[model samples]
Target: MPSIQKPLTKRAWVRLPSGRRLNLLDPTPFDFEADDLALGAARTVRWGGHSVWEWPLSVAQHSLTVLAIGEAEAPRPLTAAQKLAFLLHDASECLGVCFDPISPLKPFLGEGYRQLDQALQTAVHRRFGLPADLPPAWKKPIKTADKRAAAAEAIFVAGWSLAECREALGIRAAPLSADPLTPIYGGLPWEPWPARIAAERFGAALAGLAGSMP
Candidate 1:
């Protein structure tokens, strides 16, 4: 009789601060907690820990910035769901245990990472009562706002030149009055907030948006 062999299982789990383990490769349906998002995002650094700020800018702060930009740049007022979607646009990044620039990794990692990323994003959307996919009309403004936010982040926090950042992000140079280094959106300055404060503010914003649901 030949010896029977069992295949080895690859580990693809990330443990949350809440002690919950998520299998990133094949995540099971799980409830998304606002606390987990707030805390995790607050700790996740933007620019892959390469920011020029005194402390790394947290994803929580980045989310608030994007939401603010989306609201300010939208042609009309956005509904609660739209606002939530904007805030959570990068929520999937918080679920990952490490940071890898997606653009650079895509060619090597291929579609598998993208599928996992989308699954995490859909999970986040469902958790907050948003549709898994945003309508086409809404996506444009959100994406534009997101790019503007990225342009500002690159210039201010990541120490990139204005021309270079704009070119890389495909955004127009900021107006003289709207200095890229000192950009303001939604009447809020683009400065990095403390991690704890960012987490608290994110939770508050999430609560307000969730409460507004009919």
Candidate 2:
């Protein structure tokens, strides 16, 4: 069957590496591949490229760090859906941008930005057999894990002192000194990784999570 035609407006079409044009205004689960999400995320810089490392931290790496942090803090092992959520939390940011918009700037971008993100997120969730929204049981732990990930990244990669993280970044909780991924990924703990390596590692995890889904 012929795929649905692109939206009338030219701006709606975003061409992917596989030559599939995703309609950002109305995305579908089949619009992209896991590899596409992984590569896009690996290239999307976090902390606005302000990291102390040679290369800026990528969302790919941050997602994994968040997973590791979540595992360390969880009362029990995270469900596969929850783990998938953590890995794909920032997947939408990778669609057409190379940088994550800082929290302060998201408001100015208006509801359009918010809707686009939600649309893509919904598609991402359905694509992997997850609920359109995160389960309530999963939210609190993921939020805390994400914050902890930020705290760690701020201090270790972005050159922010712990005090600065508290006073300036408003992360009151303490950051983790040891990264859970160190044993698996084998790098300087919490340091930013090159985009290529980040993508490769992220791809491995993405495949595992997606395959685990019923």
Candidate 3:
């Protein structure tokens, strides 16, 4: 008689740099750490590493840029939570597999991914002590700032023509002089920072913002 062979089970969890494991298949409550966020985000490249720069832009830089833009555009001083929200807008992207923007892929990937993304986003927000759903008043400005960063990224790093980027992203590139934050666009022509520096800067920014929270 032939013996029955045992089937192998696949591992569904991912271990982060900080030694914490996240189960991708099952949503569970896990403590969020700034170090893990910084490390993961620093290593995740934007534009799916399709940028024309010598080094691919990391999501860490993108997050920082968005925060800067939001800070500059706020009519009055922003709260600590609002600043943290901007800095963490892409924190879920640190998960690596779900980093792609959903707009272009939504039709093909359908609503499943969108739902998953939102779930992850809510978790991230909760981890940082923010409301599960961002208030619309804050959400709008952050999204606008994010789009402006996207337009700048498309033009400077991805090497897309202004018209092409504008049409694709549905956002007009703000004039470089329109805001102090706009200078980040000019710096895009330079090579991206190394992962270590990106991580450090992200961590530092988070610390600074947390200290300033009122």
**Candidate 1: misplaced stretches above 4 Å?**
1-3, 8-11, 28-31, 96-102, 167-189
Residue pairs whose backbone atoms clash in candidate 2? none
The CA lDDT of each predicted structure is 0.74, 0.85, 0.74
Q: Where does candidate 3 stray beyond 4 Å? A: 1-11, 28-31, 96-98, 173-190, 211-214
Clashes per candidate (backbone, < 3 Å): 0, 0, 0
What is the C-alpha lDDT profile of model 2 across 12-128, one tens digit per residue? 787887677788888899998888888889999988889888889999999998888777778888888889988888888887554588777889999988998888889888888
Best by lDDT: 2
Model 3 whole-model lDDT (C-alpha atoms): 0.74
Per-residue lDDT of model 1, residues 178-198, tens digit only: 433234323234567778987
List the candidates ranked by TM-score, beginning with the highest: 2, 1, 3
Specify the poorest-scoring 10-residue window by lDDT in model 1: 175-184
TM-score of 1: 0.83
Candidate 1 deviation (Cα RMSD):
3.5
**Residue-level lDDT for 49 in candidate 2:** 86
RMSD of each: 3.5, 5.0, 3.7
As a whole number from 0 to 100, the lDDT of residue 186 in candidate 1 is: 35
